[model samples]
Target: MTSVGTQEKTRPCPRCGAGIGGDERFTVWCAACDWNVDPEGPRKEPRRLDRTRRALARRHGEKLHAGIVSGEDLRARRDASALLALVIALAVHGVTAAVAALGIWCLVHGWGGWPMLPGLFLLLLAWVLRPRPASLPDHVPVLHRAAAPTLFALVDEVAEVAGTRGVDAIVIDGAVNASVQAYGMRGRRMLVLGMPYWEILTPQQRVALLGHELGHYGNGDVRHHTVLGSAYASLITWWYCFAPEDDPAATALELISNLLLLVPYWLVTGVLLLLDRLTLRASQRAEYLADRTSAHVGSTEAAVGLTDRMLVTDSVEAVLAREANRAALAGPSGYRAAGDRADELWERLTSHMASIPEAEYERQRRVGALRGHSVDATHPPTHLRRAGLIAGERMPAAVVVEGDRADRIAAELAGARRLVGRRIILDGPSFGG
Candidate 1:
């Protein structure tokens, strides 16, 4: 067999096109690119598992490309999977409950000696298999309509055009991403907008983002995921309740029990993996449908631009974060100054993207394409989406907001931006206390 160092010499670094040198250690670093790799990292799935995932992704891609599976069909399949999961959960509980009941009957008939052990175990199993209710985040600040009427008005317009229910609440966050979530038993809608991400986009692009989020509701993606996610969580809870502990078996009985537990462990894990694989394709399709909805409600150009900017914004954030940290370390009063620096860096970086050549930009995007397809990814690769939009027929321009109306909405968001910035500084790496 080839030595590890020799093998590493043959492979190029993923980030920089330089040969990598490997030692026998589990961790490897590429000097040329400053890239680090850990063989035992969480991203390193087993080879057989990787192969199976690739095969599933390939099959799904083929079906999607061939038009063999419609978005409606994928939605139906997810719903069916949710139903099947529920049925399996109920069946397990029913069987366990019956076993527990039989043990109770035996005790009442004076047959209770060793029967008590099995009865208790059966009752525990039934309790473990019980379905759990979904959880909502606590302590999250919810923005009311009175505080940001202009923002809420924009969301209302987007929802009306997308044919989705109005957002029940809005949340301003510190991250560079935006999302919509369902909360409570009624599945009330919550629209979360990252102030950093919002500050980077124009009014038109903002509308596209809003449309994309609300489109999840219109496409039933939210409902499907809520049901499926809850079912998966219930299965995980059941698995954990009976999972074997990490201790060596010192006796034959202990070893036998451990071996038996492995059966259910593998069975439940397999089911979870299968459910993940099935729903992942649906999730990716939903992203595309949502993108289309965004293009419909806003302009196709705005949607495409928003997608491209997202790819660039990640890099921008990383560089600015380090600068902010450095600024904070310079002096006793540096923390407040760092926050302002972050805003300036964000604006500069975003503005600079427009000057880059289209050819160079496309080349940069292809780097993500090289990472290979994601089997369990929530969204398709950014490059793939951009390519699809470019090759497709042009859409009619549908400007949702413009002139003073857009300006008023953006002006209103200034207060929100300050709050988000303060939150970021307090929670950010630059803050010491």
Candidate 2:
């Protein structure tokens, strides 16, 4: 059998017609494509070291990253914390139940009666029925190895601004974005980039995006989200206990429980969902902080503004545009390529949007207006995000100027600065001023 160690290779600069002479000419710059692929694997991996040495070298790295988790890997910590909250509440419910039982015993004896016993039961029952955690995986991803240095550079800026350790892993996926995810107890962390990110964003924008993710990680954010999620969950208990069961705690308890059933659970659920969304405002606030950090590191306004651009996201609109409508130029897979024409497609889809039903379309328009407020959503609109910079609200991220990357970086900074509608000189000394 032939071994992969010996192979021939030739490739071009994916963006332009220039021939990349060898593996050394490229870096993992594109968060979108993961990394440049060669027909030959050497072509990529063998240049650094042999397979055995590479495997052995990662042992120390694995140890260093032992506690970090990110992205979907967050399920474990979320579930564990949720379970803990439930246990505490259940313990309290037990106490509440016992007190109610004592009241019932008194009422049965023809003594003055207590009425809250049934409400306690309702609270317990709600706790038992809250949604269970969804299953998650235990695998660590193999991100584009070439992108590590650039990702590290961004991580270093975050560390400087945030006063903490740098990122642990640089994961590449297909999401059109970059996110920071931490796992384990001691912040085993990752800088996860989606493949779509490169196709859709410029380098400065990518840097800004990384800064946003870093903001979430450095601010002790995961724990905050967990606590907030649990609090929102506790609302179920609140609604349940608003009135007890209808069986009869004297006659008044029965009447109240029946009346309580009329209490709008729908309204209660909406209120709980709203509270959860507001709690996530903390995460949103963290984004602004991270952007500030990125600007401090010398990321151009353009780079940071890239995130601002994406903030205008409307998934519902994007989906509708991609329907069987004639303007649907491509499907999801086509959009994954390095140069998929997303803007063209979005424009095409919107152009034909006049044909859809009015009532249904109106609802979507309302959704577009409320895009940022949904409980499970993240990332804000590009224009709204851009407005911050124009308003002089964010600092430019420190950008890397090397080789061909230099010219593009400068242009990106200028582009982002314009989008922000304002500019500030970003020097190394002043961090938070």
Full-model lDDT for every candidate: 0.62, 0.41
- TM-score of decoy 2: 0.41
Per-residue error for 55 in candidate 1, Å, reads 6.6
Q: Name the top lDDT candidate.
A: 1
> Candidate 1, residues 1-433: lDDT per residue as tens digits?
2222433334787889787654322234455554653222333444443455555654555455344223233332345754565565455556556766775765565454776677666656556654445334443446778877887888888888888877878877666778887667877778888776776777788888998898887876632455555665566675675576666645777777778888877787686567656565666667666777788777888888877776666444654465556656776566666456545554554554444334334434544455433423345656556665554556754547878887787677766665556445444522110
lDDT of 2 by residue, 196-259 (tens): 3333455555555655566565654532343343444455665565533545345876776566
Candidate 1, superposed: residue stretches over 4 Å from native? 1-59, 66-140, 222-225, 236-264, 336-360, 373-376, 429-433
* lDDT of candidate 2 at residue 334, scale 0 to 100: 42
Q: How high is the lDDT of residue 433 in model 1?
A: 7
Q: Candidate 2: lDDT over CA atoms?
A: 0.41
